[model samples]
Target chain A: MAGGFAESGADLELVGISKRFPGFTAIEELDLTIPAGSFFALLGPSGCGKTTTLRLIAGLEEPTTGRIYLGGKDVTDTKTYRRPVNTVFQSYALFPHMSVIDNVAFGLRRRGIREARALAHEALKLVELDHVAARRPAQLSGGQQQRVALARAVVNRPALLLLDEPLGALDLKLRRQMQIELKVIQGDVGLTFLHVTHDQEEAMTMADTVAVMNKGRIEQMGAPEELYELPKTVFVANFLGQSNLFTGPVVSSGKDSIVVDIGGRKLEVPRERAQRHAGEVTIGVRPEKLQLHGAEPKAAAGTNVLGPGRVTDVSFSGVSTQYQIAIPGLGTVSLFAQNRDVGAVLREGAEVWVSWDVAHGFGVADDPADGPRFDPDDDTRSIAVQRREKLEAELEGA
Target chain B: MAFGAFGGSPATTPASDAAPRRGGLIALFLLLPGAAYLSLFFLVPLVSLILTSFQAVDPNAFEIGKFVYAFQWQNYVDVVTTYWPHILRSFGYAALATVLALLFSYPLAYVIGVKLRRFPLLQALALTLVIAPFFISFLLRTLAWKQIFSDEGVVVTALQALSLLGPADHLTGTPFSVIFGLTYNFIPFMTLPIYTSLERLDLRYVEAGGDLYASPASTFLRVTLPLSLPGVVSGTLLTFIPASGDYINASRDFLGSTDTAMIGNVIEANFLQLQNYPAAAALSIVLMAVILVLVGAYVRRSGTEDLL
Candidate 1:
């Protein structure tokens, strides 16, 4: 059964693609390429054009401009049916009237393949849903229906399988289970799978390559770990995970590292990790990378330390405890400590020092007008103030 | 009494016992008006009609309404033999009209429901146009069609000029006019239900068909048609049941004459002009039984029993 769908996948290339609807553009002059047999994820929030890109690749929507190539052949003008692509839609969209076996066999029968039912049964077995072969889609649970949807698409053995948030509707546990199952399925079939989702963790966990999309363009794209560790843009840092950012000017540019001055405190970022060398830069450190100490600890030679801040809030989750420390000059910075510490849990109003290795810090070009600035003397301005201001602005505009 | 019988069950759980007994009484009370209305208006008339169908006509009386209560099943036999042609014509015309109406309305419903969905205003306007005919009286609408297809009307004259009709041919008081009237009148019935189903249709299913390597036409046949089968079944039933028993379109004063008379027209003549109540009642019962059987078989074969 696995051998029947073991054909190698085709590489997909989109050149200068732009999709413009009335009054607004869905995607702007985008170029993307997915090497065959790789699981690539397009990760973004809703309305960020990730789904549109998937649709464009699937040939469900024509690009307003630019060409598409599949396996070195231009298929820009090909109809959706003519393209060797299939989609596991966001809603699954199984034919409610069709039995599970028939739903899986639909594509095979359409291509006039002989013995379609036997192949469909094999596909169902691949998804571990063969027991529900004779049941209608409405009769199955949501997770079962989702598996049926996956089986239906994979059975076609299309060159590229487009998954449009295929697990969005499932419960968290089922979604995680399906994510692993999907990766295994992709490996078995050796097909190019383009999974589109808003979930950053899902993308990070399952994709070989993760592309962070914003507005209508790709913010950054690389291997999941590479993109997470070395995000080149502020949006990527903020969207992919929690980041504690500080905007400052580059005071010293050394051959090995760039030192940035933030409200009288100095921090060093590795020269290669710094996107900008001399101009104003926004440096960011992940919360988990930051270590919290009750007292001023001895800092290593290359370690960056910011300190003497009062802990404003402490939340002890089962596996980790998160602390929001408010520095006098800076607004607030969040740090996460794993539950490995056997000492007393840090309480609110406790004085703490935050430190991380200089190598863990990354810097992107600063935009002064984009977000809130931390007032040096006033410690009252926080995320709430920023959010209230944003809401007020939106209300006034509306 | 029904409430007492239900409450007397010994297997009731203590927590649910009182609540269920009260609920049953309330349900019975709520059912009073509709049950009484159906029994008084529908059941009483149905029973009287069946009884009259088996009554013996008075051979000695001069009055027309005089008949003796007896099991004269021959009344059913006489009516069936004398009006079998009319009965067959009624069903045949109804079937053709239903088919024509479906073909005409399916596209209309698709456009209103799916194609124009982005423009809600246009969809609403198109739906209003479909239902606008109901604003006029059914008789008035049939009469309007009769005038449009009359001997001197524009349609007949144009057909004559186009050599589509014989020189001496007339349009009104013909089978074509009657069937045409039936199709036109019940088009809204067919279009509305199909539109409802199509409106609720998730477009992703159609797109999924295309994504699975099915062509545009094939997608429509396999996905769109089967998903909307319930609507089609109901629409056909709505059109056929009434169109088969319609008297206005096939009346002599409307679009039909003696040659195009249906069972409805035959029953009307016996009941009103001829004052042959027993024959009319027997014919009415036959029409009811035949329609019941056909609709039952149709619903069963269509596999939409859940819809009914």
Candidate 2:
């Protein structure tokens, strides 16, 4: 939590931003404040408008509503080149004809930078690309070219550095290496970094603050650990990690929690009033938290109880084994056990006791108030799209 | 030598199956028609002229010693010594015309290609204007130039009115008229190739250059022009070759300035007026040889055979 708060010098705020393209809205009523020198990430799936948010912040696109404040100045209508922000595009977009030194010095050249060679040398040294400064982009590897792009943007010394999936083209090993490099660079420069990525892993690894976007809006925004530990919606939970959901009706509601009867088994979870309903509630549990024993506990357990079940299947991974257990009156539940010792092995068809702590389950007592009200007409949309594609193919053939 | 870890040694094919089977038949089928046409129209006439070069003309104005086989390779030496200045003049005029054509068309083609890319009809119209001169007869166009640069023409009238010249006698039959006609007739050759190349130039390079902080002009000089060198080479070759050999404009349009007579005029005069078949054939051979050398150098420089 040392760098969790905003820094003092590089404050950026997006105030009540809204952007619409004809009839479609790309981003709506978005607001964010990033402290100076903080690494911030916008995380979302494709078409979630995360890239659009980064573009708007870079002044590449204008917001239909609201203002952008850099430090304290409003720059909502400023053109991209006029703003004090530079972007490293996803494709790296390095000029193919120019040498690495020239590419790095290009922004300075525009500003009529005196001693451009020395400044370019310094920027290349920072990116550890000084030795190859005379080489063209086609001669450099993908990782080296990306570093050149970074050096090119940073040499301008813009107030904010924007990254639009700068590592999206790298392979897994290279991407991991670049993630570390980018983090180190951000720390060394002490510049505000606004990065856009769809990778939850990248966001968790690098960002000081993470904002998860969905359907043109921020679904949740917080530190990675906070979002991971307490997701507020099924979309966030499913996107962040794996979860198994159980559907049932609410049996009782308490001051801070609710008990739901899932297939005759009572499970207690945190009471979120927005989702509180008496019937048709769902409970989510992580598979790793469930435990399995050969049989039920010798005595009646405490609030954390054991359920009788038969192990239907066992899967052996390199470091862990998963057991799928079927409990009577309840559906099959999955249990994950790490290889703690030599003898912690479960076989298929073994009768076992599956147990979980009551507090571990996350409850969402279904409220019709919150959205995605399970419509019956979603199938028609896919059917229409398929039909259109078929018609287009036939027209081309004709 | 050490292919142990990566893979086995490369495979070898049997020598028995190496040669192309039934190859000469296919080759002949593809080439015989063209070969027959060249022999009938080109090869036989060339051989007859070479045979005629050794003969002495009789008093009856008929060529004798058709079969005496008195080989006169000195005919080539005499013709070379007599026509060397005309050869140099042709090259000078062609070089000047090519330079003038490039100057006039490069900006026009660049604008049509890069600036008006979104308006395709405008590009086509611009291209049509460059090619419009070719639609008229070469004789007619040369005649038009003759009138335009003549003493009684409008240009002479205008210059006289402006007092830029003393009188109408100063204007006609100058070398300026010949070069102008040459440039006007062949300017389209310079435009189309350069236009096509500039049109196909990748816009991504420009955007990338701009993003790197390069002004538009620097991008053009550093990225666009160097990459369009192939087009320049092809356009120069296309305009220079035909203009060097052109005689219709020189013979019909301008006064017989020794410096203005192109090599094509030499070939045409020997063929039609002097009735010197041997001289005409030898001169035609020399022109073809020069063209082949220039075209070969151009092709080698461009690293492509399709430079034209």
Candidate 3:
């Protein structure tokens, strides 16, 4: 693993952290270490425990049984006010009554620090909101309010910063811009940021290290590229981005490679990615990893897997062209390609050859009843929220 | 602007620049009826009262009790000298009752709105209890309190048993009992508005305050209290204005003695017993003017002009 402040010691630690509400366990048996000064993200879909994990670190919620350490001190039993941590809430939560400067300097004034206004001015300047310091939060635009929230948290200079979907309220364009700005500010300030987000793209763009959480446990933790390319579970593979999976019994296992036959066609996968499976496995490749050609291509040196297919769906998504291809024997597969130099747009029913390198194929333990990827955007506290919503809809339907 | 705040889509968009203008026009139209009512009842009475305050009482020139409005401006000066103690006492009692009601209701509202929120049933029950006072007649409720604080009632008997009060001392008709009656009767007024604001308060700001290293007290004072000020302002106005002009609660027949008479009691006596309409009108005008000025100053100081 790469080393830096992460090796210096964990800035925040949670050991055996679990939180149980009256009806259900929100988070269970979770242990995580956010390296000092690293931009880390807890990424998952709406019902995942990523947000719960962030709340535990911010001292907003106490664990049912666990210890929380901040900068090498055990703060498990400490009050939230005494903990050296701060959070930028999803709603911004700026004091609607106070001016922007008062909102930003609130922590310092509580700490009894002299020259709080000066410090607040500096923090606002960092977010480029100093000019509007005298205005109330209600008077500011959404994006500006979000910046004030960011400034308010950073001004405290806490040992660790927790951001709970801090950019969730902004428009898509503003969210994209703030993602860049957040990364820059995290870099400049060098504060350990534990960002919780459901947006995979937001996680990938801003965090140096990403931990994809599901239910209440960490599914995978690594660099964004590693999690995207070498996902260990079907949930992680599909949740990070779209994936094409080939489920079949493993025919051969190798030190350098593994051979799996799919629909009477043999495809080779690199052995390094196949170590997690034994019997039945699914070899997965990302949609963008597959290359398409008009004619059937011969197996090349690096591209050991190749197949002929017919396009079932051709979707033009501005930046990339998405095509759903149906192999003769295989069910269906998805391929994404840059639209830059396309000679002609591929229409539905067009025949094509799809190929990818052995390195792109990774294995995951195949589950019998694997469903389609769940990517709902309306995030709340619990996984059962969706189920309850579905039940309510059904009751209304009748 | 109602739809604009929610951000209208291009498909269903109204005229952008004209939205707030149209909204304001509709608001004006909606306000016209209430404005007309206030002008007819409140504005007309107030103007008549101001004119009547300057009238002279010529007892025999008219009937035994009637008089022309002789524009005697000295009526105000004569009433101020005559009833200055009653005016001061009215304000003092109102101010004390307002402060007491605030202290009592804030914690109640906070607990109901924030602490008990997760228990919807309990929050609903608590809120109903707060508003339950309105179900009973106000006069009956004050009478109930008068009974509770009577010389031989449980409260005074307990105080005597505890040696906290002398056997001869009684709470039936004192300044304390009058203030207590005002506070008890108007508590719901102070609580519900504060509860409305507190109910909608985002707990995230409290969490944010804690995250910023503020103690619980600090968070309450700086965040919770300031955020709930709009409610506090409205609640105090609702409680104080009516309490100052309340004759029934402080009348000798109720919980108060003649010594504890407020301005409202004096006006009642002048209008009913003495049949002195000019003096009552002058006192009523002064009371209204005082309340308006005080409430105006208060709302301005609280920085809750949006509420007013």
Candidate 4:
């Protein structure tokens, strides 16, 4: 794997890197190797070390331990200006006084590039911003200024391009547009792109390889689809997409699957998924994989396992209908059903059977290292959404 | 009609009726004292000066004029030409003194304003030193300089010991000594304003320039110097205008008849010794006009009238 990645000539290797600021650890034992010409994303919640890892790779901060390698050379102690890397800050950080063309030419000018005016004109044309070449940053819209910053960094053709939440400040529509634009630019330049973001949808769409980080450590790293489908850790499962997790114990083990007795219901899930100590386990299933049927299946069809549940809530999305079902012994489980037409409507408080293919259900091994069991009633809502509400209420109070 | 279309009207309207009542009171409070003071001290003295300039001095040395109708216009012409060299000498000394003061003060001001911005104690020390020259009386300082430059003075004696001085009356009473005195006296005026302007200058521009790959020297020349022009021009004007009218340095350092005799000495001589009030007034008027014209052209050339 390392050899295949290295021959591409722009591999970025971060080894045993740890950064600490006084009492806070920003990055700990971070080891990641990104292939050349790949769009890689460091996806995490806020303050989970995604931005810190980007800064470390850019040589803006020194790691407490280990080394960073760019193009197969150790560049752990290199100065930001001397390194073959550039960052597009979230604020755009365009020089306010200079024309857009000059802003693009700033790094080149520092390197004593002759004919800067002509070269800057070319870079602007690359970003499709040549029309605003003579305008200052303040005169342009937010999107135009962002394009200028992008052009400014790529004009150097550095080995690695670091983007620190570069699209966090833009509106959703603009962000989606810029995402396609960034991918195209990275493909054209053939430089290693390391993007940091807290938006899971953004990471899924833009990144070829998405690394999910939590509390300064990567929980999983793989192709976007691979990570989303077979997320080994509960953190990765909930972070990448919506998951309805059920905790219980393993009633029996099979050749290729395990039957988990969740509350009182038995679930036969993929045995290859995660380790099961033969007692306690949690089963995770994607909401889209779950299905609801009005009639119970025949008990003789042993391969197709089923359980009865009542529809507690029904939410209408534009193209789909989402149902929250409460099992007799199990907690609420969410399922998304395709909305074929207006006639295909499901009412709340209606009895239904919930079932899924064994392949779709993954058995997460119980953590033996855990000190104690978590209360089922513990709040499992996303901390990010809760934080936003808390901040809004505090602002209103103030 | 355009004003009416905009809903504008005068005292017949309620808003207009109340505005003047308050404005009239404010006008009386703000302008009354200043106007009365200018009428008494400024205009009355200026009118009297004009009256005296036209008067003739009798044999008994008392000036007399009947409506100043018997104007001696020749006195004006005589003063202009007779003391022309002395007037030029005063201006030359002043210009040289201002230049020298700028040279001595600019670096000090730049250091205080730009480098020591966080240290208020350093500024306090500089302020104390700036006003230290004023602590000594002007006459006493000039006299002290005279003694120091005398043949038996410490400086000349040291120079003689070093075999750098010629026979007698070589160094003292020269134009150089007069300029030195003036620069020493007016150094503070040149420094404080330049320091103020430089202190208020935002340093972000310099960093921005540097990030654009311009060297530090280029940054200073292109960004720092152009932005600090107002300070330099003001400091130069402050030093130049006052120093030009100052002949005290020249009169005291040069004694009776030296190359350093300036316009102030000429004016003083005409007033006391020759008892020629008209000539003295004509000379004074000419000096004021010259200073005014120079300052006006400078302000125009600098394009900093509003800044002043």
Candidate 5:
């Protein structure tokens, strides 16, 4: 599977890359390849090693035990300047002293590109920021500066372009706008875009392929729909979106689907989608995939599974109404139903039936190697505490 | 009306009415000690110096160190005309010394702040060493340097041995020696401000520059130097202003000769040996005015709108 680099002309290839700081392992033997002219995103939670992978590819940091190839040539030992790669930094690291035009023209100027100013203007025009080309970075808003950074990197036309959370500093509205803009821009100039972000929604929105990382390792990599609909790990399921998870033992297997006894209730999931054998497994479906009813619906045949639950919480969002259902002998699970003009508006303390197609359910092989059993919405051990522990250890050694 | 429209909001009216009086009173209270101290120490000396600059001594009155005060403003003209060369030389030497100090300090500060940042212990050690000279007296340091470049000293001897200098040529009692001493003595002042600015610099810009394919040297010139201008301005000011009026380094009895005498040395000679207080006072006033003008022009030219 990894040998595709030879046939398809991989724009970037990282073979067994690992980066270790003094007391922390950033990435552990990561292997990834991106085909030319594709927008790929590395998505993860903080400290999950997505950024380290990008940095290693950009030649900002050297990997400890791997070779990095750009356009099928090993550039593992190349200096950042020598590497034909550019990065849009998270802070938009624009030279504060230079005008926006100069900032955009910086890469070309370094390469001794004649008519740097005219070309820089062309790049700014690409981002629709040529009007503000003469202004310094501080004079522009965060969104404007972000575009300039994009223009700067894109003007280089490097073999690989890495964006380290380029839209992270913008507000929600601007971020959404920029996300679409980025997708359009990527389409316009199809360099091998490698964007790193901790935001799952952003990755789903922009990248053609998304890699979900957890604790210095990639949990799953595929198209966003594939990862979301058929996540191979509980981490991917929880991280990509909210997934109502169930841990149970497999009762029977079929050519098409597998039936698992989830604490008593038998649920059928597509057999190929199940990453486990006929044994213990953890399975989940996204909140929106399950339907909620006032009473038990007639058990439909042909891959439809049914379960009885009671509505514990009712949250009516503008477009969708969400219900927290407490299944008997099973934990509470969330399900979102679209708000309709003619439907029974479910309320708290109402008896409800949660039903989903068997094909919607996905299963993982119930491994104990999960990185932090996380509540998707709840706080985990914060990075500050971990950093403090590292510092204290460092001090003690000192 | 525009000011009133913006300013006279009902929410802020009461605060403004009460605050101004309270603020003025508080401001007065805050100003009392500093203002009184300046009036006593600074204003008094300045008033006496200005008065002395306008005074004249009777050439016939042979009472030792006697001066009957008169509005003899020609003392300013006389001092400027007689000591113009010394004044120009002082400024020239100061400019050279300041430039030299900046050149030496930029690399030192860069290494300490950026290069050694990962090694906090080493960085602190290097910074401490940079500031260690302040522990020693300036006079002692200058005198030590004077010894190092004395007529038959090791520096001159080495230069002679290398044939870079003739046997009769010397490092002491020259413009070069005085300027060198000034640069050496003021290096810490130049270094610390630059270290502060460079320490506060975002390393990501350098990384971004590199990622853009700019070499390290070009990055330093384009990104690092421009951002560190505030520090350079402050460092140069700190070196130049003091060096311009420095007496110890250019004292004929110490490291300099008559030919190498600066404005400060001339002022010293007129005040103590010649006992021409008016000329010295006039020259002192001229030096202060020139420095003020030059520093203002410099600060303005640097366009440090953000820094100041």
Candidate 6:
């Protein structure tokens, strides 16, 4: 790699950042530190302030109250052009009037760097788009334009690279391909990348650290596996992936585990996995971690079991069969079973028990605001119908 | 009765054939009014003017308006030679006015379109003020300016007080007053198009420029200006084409004197006072041809022909 293409990365720090517009706050008092040469992802739904954070770091937006430090140097008041940062905007924002090569060379030329085009060519080659260097951005496909945008920012060799939902416009297949390419390129260049996206899968597949943002706050931040295996908050648990949650009071606290009374049944949660062990607590287990049995098997030690409930729905995807079991007092729980035993596909209305290892059950403080209300009407509607209605309501509210 | 009616119809008639034929008939019918209006008002007059340009004055006629139908091609040559200075002066003044208007309107448009975008009410008010002048008559506006620059008017007196103009130097009926009137009257024309283009400009491109390490001025030079060239081209065309052939600002009754008489004034004088139909017609044709060539070259040079 060329020396100009692989400048050592600088760490970014945002201290007490708060951004407020006319009526609403975009980002509340938030502090985050991104280590040098780390591929970090800020994962959040829309309106969660992840993009705002990225903009603040890029100097496109100034925090209402905060200091921004890059490599331990305070740059809070620096102009966007003076900051050693570049961003791949969500829309690509490629200059339509300029050719692709010119677009990539723009930052280099602005910095008065010699051999700007040669450097731009090398950057384009890194993205595997050197062949289309002479074409305009409008002439390229969405995936091609995305790479061009990446190359344009990467060529600058800035201390930090901010990607704001950069692959949001690509198709699913193309997005998957670009995710891998982006990781490879990030490794090759070794620049600190702050990727802001709403797609949890994209974040988990690429980022070294994923921060789940909700309502202008970072609910949880950790490695992808750590976050998935054990989320710290209800928002993080629900937003990252599907989590089957059972909320109840902690009936007993022991040295190594805490027993929670969930709807007449008692479940044991590991003490280390539980964020809180007193008052009302919500224990969660991932769908894939839970195993479904046709009948009550022999009680295994270190196992938490639920549901001598009837199966309400069974959906057979290519690789896995997802089953929804409706317990009498508790609501329906989702379970994903890998297609290892094809002949053992359980039918709807079958009485089944869902069980998981006690270590797999994680606990978080019960969030009453987002807790599922058990509606008598919910039993009549299928899970898919309920999901669609919830989606419609959310859309209307948005 | 329904069965008999259906059975009597031709079963082999292709439904697609009748539909397209009917569609074609409807399209032709829809195009009739506009085509007829153009032919009657525009095409007929144009052909007549072209024919008149080649006619000769009849010496044997008793009336002043009488003309002889002949291929008198020398009429074009005669008008060019006799009024070449007036033609040159028209173009020069129009070009100056267009440049001046652009210089003034670009910043105004940018302020209204880009800067005030956050304050939409203010932007709308600014745009309304730009367009509000159209409610008044164009002639009245020029006359208003003529009054403002009169010898005894406030502007001339102020300039005299500042010693910028000599005591005897008047503002009215000079080249300055005439060109100024053209620019002022057509400023809205120049501003509205440029404003529209600037308003539609996606600001992310500008932000990208800043992110790419270009300073504010450099970003404008490298991005904003080039992207808004389409608007500039159209704005200049809108101001230049009419300003070049406009007689009101150059007429003796308005801002001009004999020294500042343009091709439009000459054409008006030839047609109305001198009754020289051929010369007037020839001048009009020449002006149209020149404006067409100028605008074409400009659009081509700006590389915004695709936009047109």
Native-contact fraction for each model? 0.92, 0.21, 0.97, 0.10, 0.92, 0.90
Best of the candidates, lDDT = 6
Against the true structure, candidate 6 has what lDDT?
Answer: 0.90
**Which stretches in model 5 have alpha-carbon errors above 4 Å?**
A1-10, A303-307, A342-344, A373-398, B1-44, B151-170
**Candidate 2 residues A93-211, lDDT tens each?**
77665688988887777667787789889989998989999998889999998999999888777778889899988887999999999999888878889999988888889999998
- Candidate 6 to truth, TM: 0.92
Model 1 residue runs over 4 Å out of place are: A1-6, A342-344, A366-398, B1-18, B306-308
* Most accurate candidate by DockQ: 6
Which candidate, 1 or 5, would have the higher TM-score against the true structure? 1
lDDT of 5 by residue, A296-390 (tens): 68877644454577788766555776678887888888887888865539778887787888778888755434545554321121333455579
Residues forming the 10-long window of minimal summed lDDT in candidate 3 chain A: A1-10
Two-chain DockQ for each candidate model: 0.50, 0.14, 0.49, 0.11, 0.45, 0.55
* Model 3: per-residue Cα lDDT over A247-312, one tens digit each: 777788777887887877777888888745456778889888998989878767657455678898
lDDT of 5 by residue, B213-297 (tens): 8888988888898898898999999999999999888887678888889999988888998888989999999999999999999
lDDT of the candidates, in the order given: 0.89, 0.75, 0.85, 0.77, 0.85, 0.90
Q: Alpha carbon lDDT of residue B22, candidate 2?
A: 41
User: Residue B155 in candidate 1 has what lDDT?
Assistant: 95
Candidate 1 lDDT over B109-140, as tens digits, reads: 99999999999999999999999999999899
Q: What is the TM-score of chain A alone in each candidate?
A: 0.91, 0.81, 0.89, 0.88, 0.89, 0.92
Error of 2 at A182 (Å): 1.2
Candidate 4: residue A228 Cα off by (Å): 1.4
